[model samples]
Target: MTGKIYIIGLGPGPAGWLTPEASAALEKVTDLIGYFTYVDRIPPRDGLTIHGSDNRVELDRSRHALQLACEGKIVGVVSGGDPGVFAMAAAVLEALEHGPQEWRALDIEVLPGISAMQAAAARLGAPLGGDFCAISLSDNLKPWSLIERRLQAASDGDFVLALYNPASKARPKQIFDAFALLRKLRPAQTPVAFARAVGRPDERIVLTTLGEADPGVADMSTLVMIGATTTHLIERPEGRPFVLTPRSYEANR
Candidate 1:
């Protein structure tokens, strides 16, 4: 008699952006589980069990939440940004696949959300307008060597690079390593952008060239953008910020 589990996307923090479908699912859920900070985004509702945990225990917590759903409790496994983009959706699916027998039978639906990359790209005026790829600097799952390969591939291809999980306490050197790698393939004057605490009140956006940029300035919550060879900064008389990557070769030239 297990109830279906809903993997909900909380978007970037605003309740207004929560899709009606997601909101309805959240309202019906008897249990809400997510990274501690993300769980706080849901509006208060009665008869809901809130399960929060440290970032390290995401897989364990998600497994437990799915088990709760299998036990007949309506559950919501939440993620900040899009659940599909380097978020809980993939983790939860992996947990179910590799988990014990009971987990495989549970019904799971993954809902999308506004990812930080999309939000940041919007805020920065479309740096991701052309071919782009996203890579996470966190070595917790993927090895740094693999990250470097991907970064090199993307940089050499002149793809707009969106970086996530750029920095963490135990892996402070990762961003620096990536920065060094990119510097080798791309020009030292390549433009880069960073969005900190995006979609939240404390959010800040920075635009600068690679020569002036420092990876040490980033943290776990920051999203970094490194422009392709065709990317450039356009200055406005009003001092507005904009980064553009051309789609056509003529536009790029």
Candidate 2:
């Protein structure tokens, strides 16, 4: 009785942004697997066995999920953001492609979730309103040199950037280094947003320019968004100014 596997993105925090499809998938799964905190985010339900694992063990977690599904246990592997975006969706696919051919024939689905960048963009107005790209700042899977080159290329291409995994206790310097690198390529006034724990009770959003941004404010939970040269601010009398990157390229005619 082989079963299916669902890779679900729980969204930035949890229930707030979970898509109805994702919610249903979670409910249907006999087993839920993911990072410890992400697994805990699911509300307790009957008959769902949750498998919580450590950080940086994505491949192991994914393979295990596939195995469980092959053994007839419907499974859902959760990711905090959209599974396709620097998350478990890729890992699951990688495992399927490399693990066992039989695993490929099983029904597999990727349920989308609101990415942290999307949550950050909404909270900070529309910094990603225009042409933009998302990049993972963590070099755990790739080299730092490649990341630097990509940063420079994004700056050169004049695209607003949404950087994920910007900082963590283990690799704190990368975020600061990234900021420093961008400091040289872009103007000092390029707006940088540090959105921490979006959608969570302790969420924080700090907007600052590249010139005066304090990297110290960011931690593992922060998602950083850097505006392009054309990105601008719109004043609001009541609250903080809104950020927008014009969707049109018509040079302010």
Candidate 3:
């Protein structure tokens, strides 16, 4: 008999953000598979076998999980954000679609968890209150031209943009170039936020405007949110300003 696989998102960083469904699935799984860092997050147990691999081997990890499930071992593929959002759920489904027929028969479930974008937005006050879209700045899987096209369209549409994987050591210049393009389409005073490691101990949130935004402040862990034309800021006397995109657009017209 074939066992099952549950692809779960562990949330942005903290265990508190993990959904009850994801936590329940994790407790039932016999094996866990994911990027080494994510896999290491789960505490070691007597029966659970953890399989950690490199970040670049998503397909390989999916296949391994599938193979394990076929051998009657319940597997959990852990991801950092919501598994359905640019995460392991798609990778696992892609593997099942092309892998052996037996793999297709196995039971698979994808449990949702809080995404980095959601966590970041919560920390800043409701920057996603209005129309919004999320995009990954990492071009490892797709072309940079395509990324630019999407960014342009989103800007033109006045959609609040939640940019994932903004910058890394290797791709240090892309964020600056993106800022330049956004400046052309959006106003200089458009609100921008760089939320890094939300929910983690080292969490940092920087609120600024597009004209004054410092791309150097971003890194791989940062989630950059560019507010729409209607977005506004509420300055507080005690803490950081609250960033929010108003829900009604009729008032702006």
- Is candidate 1 or 3 superior in TM-score? 3
TM-score quality measure for candidate 2? 0.97
Taking the tens digit of each residue's C-alpha lDDT, what string does model 2 give over 1-253? Answer: 5799999999988466889999889889999999998998887789999899998999999999999999999999999989999999999998889998888888889988899999999999989878898989899989999999999999999999999898888898998899889999989998989999999999999999989999888888899989998888888989989998988777732
Name the runs in model 2 displaced over 4 angstroms.
none
Rate residue 90 of model 2 by lDDT. 96
Tens digits of per-residue lDDT for model 3 on 22-67?
A: 8899899999999998988899988999999988799999999999
Candidate 3 scores a C-alpha RMSD against the true structure in Å of 1.0
Residue 146 miss distance in model 3 (angstroms): 0.8
lDDT of 1 by residue, 48-105 (tens): 8898888878789778987897789988999988899998888888888888888888
In terms of lDDT, the best-performing candidate is 3
lDDT of each: 0.85, 0.90, 0.93
Worst 10 residues of 3 by lDDT: 244-253
What's the TM-score of each model vs. the native?
0.96, 0.97, 0.97
Query: What are the RMSD figures for all models against the true structure?
Result: 1.3, 1.2, 1.0
Clashing pairs in 2: none
